[model samples]
Target: MDKHSIEKEFTALIQQYRNVIWKVCYIYAKDRENLNDLYQEAIINLWKGFPKFRKESKPSTWIYRIALNSCITFFRRFSRHPQTLRLTESWDFAYEENVFSSQIQELYALIHCLGNIERALILLWLEEKSYAEIAIITGLSQTNVATKLCRIKEKLKKMSNQ
Candidate 1:
């Protein structure tokens, strides 16, 4: 494709998958400022990988792989550069309607309580991806995803009761 065509295609793809990027960033980052940084990182990674998209997998799957990888890399870098840490204040969700059932907001708050990147992985797995798909995206086995999810659920339940 020509430069203009490539840019147009990239823009369309970004618009289509923007929600996935934002949601993943929100899950990984503690607050809005970090969320924005993570979101930008994810987008940059997506753009870099666009040319290599072979269509060997579903577009959503490909997008998820890029997003999760970006989050992982961001966390690693952030860990090394602690000076980049920012305030962790909550932001209002743009949509008022429930997206993942009525308890989503509470669930999200509970997720924040977990306070780790692993929670982001578990949340993505629980987003109804098949175990195999989760494994593929996360570079883990189906059994591993299942195991982690079980532990995460127990943690959330325990947190909820507190």
Candidate 2:
């Protein structure tokens, strides 16, 4: 595709999948500024992978793979980089007052404690994706996905009880 056509297609795909993208971003980002940076990283990776996309998988599955890989890589890098600055702006309660239900907010908080791969698996499970789909998106075998998810649930059960 030509440049303009590619841009249009990419824009349309992003618009269609924005919510899925944002959920992964919000789950992985540490703060507002980090979220913004991760969002851009995910989008850039998605755009780069667009041309090579084959119709062998669902678009959502393809997008999830790109988004999750970006999050995992960036999370590792950001954790290693001590000099990454937090936002200096005054505290905003706006996000605190946002419309997500308390249960979801609490879940997000709990999700932060798991290892990165665990978080991804639980996120996919919470989204109601099938094991086959999760395996494809995460590049794991279906059996491995099932086993890891079982372990993650046990971990979460312990975490919630503490």
Please estimate how well model 1 matches the true structure, expressed as its whole-model Cα lDDT. Answer: 0.73
TM-score of each: 0.81, 0.87
Worst 10 residues of 1 by lDDT: 81-90
lDDT of 1 at 108: 69
Off by over 4 Å in 1: 80-103, 115-117
Model 2 spans with C-alpha error above 4 angstroms: 81-98
Please, what are the lDDT tens digits per residue for candidate 1 over residues 1-162?
899998999899889878877777767775657777888999999989999999898888888888878877887877653322212323454322335543666676667556444665676766788888888887888888889888888887887776
For each of the candidates, the C-alpha root-mean-square deviation to the true structure, in angstroms, is 4.2, 4.6
Instruction: In candidate 2, list every pair of residues with a backbone clash.
Output: none
Residue 7 of model 1 has an lDDT of 91
lDDT of each: 0.73, 0.81
Q: Report the CA-based lDDT of candidate 2 relative to the real structure.
A: 0.81
